[model samples]
Target: MPSSKDAVIASLIKSFEAAPRREQPYPHWYLEHCLPTADVAELTALPFPAPALGGISGKREIHNATRQYFDAANMEKYPACKTLNEALQD
Candidate 1:
């Protein structure tokens, strides 16, 4: 069985991947703003979307909101999975 850390990591990766690719203002904002808070050198080593989202730009508020969304949704599944599915349920 996958270790808890591995499960969490896999879940996180899956959550990220399963997320809709269609760009939204919120994610775009996170990509822009939160990236700076991430490691610059470390981010540079990654590729594509990771690098894109890992660098600084703008939209910090939006990023926070996005995080909140995830936190609400995956409270059970991941504790911070975001309630995107719930939002869609409405």
Candidate 2:
């Protein structure tokens, strides 16, 4: 059986190849359930960094919102997140 990672890569390739190439009224495509159920759950469970909407208003809220992105050291600490990142890169 193909590993989950392999399955995801295959799915991505298939999705891209099968995507409509012709110009339409509006260009758009969506892949439903692209990731496996477990991956979806894992990704969903991750604590996403809150958007710094207030930053747009010059409230200095961007500091807190963007902190998570600059914390690269923590990325390797979470195995699930690391794996997900690798999968995305593939």
Per-residue CA lDDT of model 1 for 1-90, tens digit only, reads 112333444444555555555556555311222222223333343332322345555876644533423234333544222222332244
Per-residue alpha-carbon lDDT of candidate 2 for residues 1-90, written as tens digits (9 for 90 to 100): 123666666666777777666557677765555666666676666677566464365556546545554134645655456555566778
The reply for model 1, stretches above 4 Å from the true place, is 1-3, 26-90
For candidate 2, list the clashing residue pairs, or say none. Answer: none
Question: How do all models score by TM-score?
Answer: 0.25, 0.54
